[model samples]
Target: MMTNHICFIGGGNMAGSLISGLISNQYPTNKITVTDPDQQKLDQLKRQFSINTEIDNLKAVEASDVIVLAVKPQVLKVVCDNIKTATLKTKPLLISIAAGIRSTDIDRWLGGNNALVRCMPNTPALIQAGATGLFANTSTSDNQKNIADQILSSAGITLWVDNEAQLDAVTAVSGSGPAYFFLFLEAMQAAGKQLGLDESTAAKLAKQTALGAARMALEGDDDPTTLREKVTSKGGTTAAALASFENNNFNDIINQALTAARDRAIELADELGKD
Candidate 1:
């Protein structure tokens, strides 16, 4: 386990998930601290994780080597401002999990020239089954990057992009990816119900099918395309369904949706970065 004194700047669900992942990986409870405005939330985390809890953000920053910015994006600027002085004094590596915020904006907010890693993690992270895309600012060292990777990977798989712009694509793909799958599951469940299955049975079958398909995709040697081809016989039910999807331009629909999502992510960065 890493011995770095890690501090989480929020006590929300994501923060709790990270703390849980760290503890499950045997990271030292004594080396972890969480700071939040809500004493009750802090108290709950303290009881649950046995880690230190503080209401003073600066005090927590001063005591840590790594700071996880797990707060909402709208309040991140204020949180950064609140702890800027202590962050400068301690020079802790900042790992931000806030969505749609840029590294440049965060660096500027924190007095600049700070080592920071900005990552986009999906909601599945709450269950330790997430996919995260990370990008490090130029000031970040290789060791700091590795540390950030270790921290995020505790929740799920981590991938690094060569440039920050790719993070926008990552945001569209994985950050909002869970919702796309959930929507598909919803459609499948509804279709099953239309096919005469009861609501509960349809829901169960759809969810289990999704889980099994995901597991197979993750564990199988064949690529998704190959797997699909193998499962879909020519002129069969699966092929007919796929043909209907093609007829309706499913690939183009997905492309347009992701493009729109990426555009929105870029717009959000611009909107959130403004002083």
Candidate 2:
């Protein structure tokens, strides 16, 4: 329902997912444009979403009110440089979804003093079940912030952070959070198989259990701790398993893992933000 002429700089999976989400929400297809180097990808997107597709980034920027920089972090500067003139001329809100690249670096790449929103969206966004963390630079207006939220929320839940530094914590939590769940699922499947279930059965049960647990946590009124306690009775199998996890110092291990992820996120930002 937003009237903004939104343009995406990449036509990859994440971009495609966002386009699909927006269109499904009744966002006007005519107001959307996507630009990418791959003609085949662009053609597929155009056919699938019925939106405008362009190989020329500048032309796309010319008529856009908001530009989603969906390109990879390594080449974001080049993409920004290519469209800087048109972006300055149009003064569109810039939303960068490239990981590790800071807002200051993106602002600088676009010739500075531009409204920019930096987001860290995980791979789950490809399925529209994403959790995205967004941070807006001081140059961004309140209206622009709302627009950015609208666009990103189409994929899944979106949370705003007051400071850009908190995005590193976001990067550690939800950004890398999916992989942690996937890893846990993998372990659960392996343990199930070790307990005599066939591979297919083990995998299916583990996946379905994860899905059910997630739904309960999301939909139920109780918090996760309360739900966990409710399910874990004394002398029960769940309690035994939880005891094993506690004996293994599971909480400390997870804290250490997230800390490492957060530290790496900070390192990546430092590396990517260099001029």
Candidate 3:
């Protein structure tokens, strides 16, 4: 349970999703505080949740026990600087969900004494099925990490990484993984359409097959490779398709794409650290 009042620095979709999930999971909605420059978002949040909402960042910073910086990467430094000025020695455990921003940069931006946790969560979180990867600075306490986990796991699964560098890989994998799956689904639907099926029927078949395959992989005892081999008989359609993929080096293509994404994530972190 979130015993401390958490203040969100932004009231966008991600922030709103976290807040809604937290409230739904038995955390006190009244203990949540939201701050946003946009009045329309603030108004909508206020109407949806019984929590406190404010336009002034300073007041929200002053009142929070745990401050979650839910703003974008571009505005993170500015928001951190404002919170630093407002709170000074009273620095709370700061949790940031901004992609590509390191905890060291967060600490430096806030004058280097604050406890900070940096995390990456995918878009599936909006549907309460997210998987988050968390990493914290040396200043963070065990209890603070637990709190952070609870807040995040309200939407889905949460895992901690020992090496901060692993977050870059995580950003490439699970953080951007959902989009890859979505893209695959789209392509499959298109392929189905090309095979003499109507768009709606093709979509239904594609989606259900994808979902069933995922469930089978997760629930069965066999490994993915083993399970795949079970359905792929010699000279069958599945075997033919698998052969085509192997011939085209699909595995290598996926590896290269993920590596490129990881490199980009690292580059973004470096850029954000440049002051």
All candidates' lDDT scores? 0.94, 0.93, 0.90
TM-score of each: 0.99, 0.98, 0.96
The local distance difference test score of model 1 is: 0.94
In candidate 1, stretches whose alpha carbon ends up further than 4 angstroms from where it belongs are none
All candidates in order of TM-score, best leading: 1, 2, 3
The global Cα lDDT (0 to 1) of model 2 is 0.93
Error of 1 at 34 (Å): 0.4
List model 3 lDDT by residue over 184-260, tens digit each. Answer: 98998899899989999989988899889888987889889998999999999999999999999999989998999
- lDDT comparing candidate 3 with the true structure: 0.90
Ranked by lDDT from best down, the candidates are 1, 2, 3
Q: Candidate 3 — which residues are off by over 4 angstroms? A: none
How many collisions per candidate?
0, 0, 0
- Model 1's number of clashes is 0
Clash pairs (backbone) in predicted model 1: none
Q: Which is the leading candidate under lDDT?
A: 1
How far does residue 106 in candidate 1 sit from its true spot (Å)?
Answer: 0.6
